[model samples]
Target: MEIIAEFGSSLLIVGCVLGFFMAWGIGSNDVANAMGTSVGAKALTLTGAILVACVFEFAGAYLAGGEVTETIRKGIIDPSLLASTPHYLVYGMLASLLAAGIWLLVASIFGWPVSTTHSIVGAIVGFSAVCIGSESVNWGKVGSIASSWVVSPVLAG
Candidate 1:
């Protein structure tokens, strides 16, 4: 009600909607993948898995989601000169959320095992590159993220 009314700003309103879509897409696909194995192995019934995921997802969102959101807002793109033109950051975020949500939906429909993290990161990078120029992006952070993607599996195996 009031929260909905609070979205009087166009970008904030759209961002809220797109954020919902992204969360729904992520929940439907990524959460299923995370819980599938346990359900398959009979360690958790489908209901049990869903319930567990609901608890943990809510917890994670409440606990760490703010940090992630803050990072996405200010970490990836340098907003040093955005004081006069502050709308681009909102535009970029809206675009990133929509892109990531759409990518997740497409990948899930095609039965592809896509990582939501990667999708969001890629969307942010692409948006930054196109909208703000590649130089505005923090390539060093991107490089670290990419390297972890490569190193994680090697270490896990």
Candidate 2:
């Protein structure tokens, strides 16, 4: 608490910058993936796909991203365990953002499809398990999310 109070402003600034980079990475990687099929099928031109993606992405983020944001923020790890060491949570989140962003950038460059959500979730799980003990993580929630990775595709198909 004391640490957070002392460095709250600086942390907020850093968080904002990292968040921007993460969003940029999502645009470069996930957006391309979302738009690829349409472009490949010639259903939309590259420019048209970009325009459509920009509009829908903004809409989705603004209208439907809240639940996901909350889940990621609180569902993956037990926040009560970090009450005594708030700085660890902040640092972990920052590190996760940096790692996920860099990974998304690299994957985009190589034309590898990746889920931004999975990257961040894996980072959080790794950090919590390593830094705060495996007990701090919500393994059940992680398992459910992991299962969705397989289940969703199968169901879609």
Tens-place lDDT digits, model 1, residues 1-157: 3333544476576878998999988997888789989999999999999999999999998999998777667677787745555566666777889999999999888878888889998898888788769998888877877898999999999
TM-score of candidate 1 relative to the true fold: 0.86
Measured by TM-score, how close is model 2 to the native structure? 0.95
Q: Any idea what lDDT model 1 has? A: 0.83
* Top-lDDT candidate index: 2
Considering summed lDDT, which 10 consecutive residues are worst modelled in model 1? 1-10
Where does model 1 exceed 4 Å of error? 1-8, 155-157
Tell me the TM-score of each prediction against the true structure.
0.86, 0.95
The runs of at least 3 residues in candidate 2 whose Cα sits more than 4 Å from the true structure, single-residue gaps closed, are: none
- C-alpha RMSD for every candidate: 3.9, 1.1
**Global local distance difference test of model 2:** 0.92
- Quick one: best TM-score, which candidate? 2
Give the alpha-carbon lDDT of every model: 0.83, 0.92
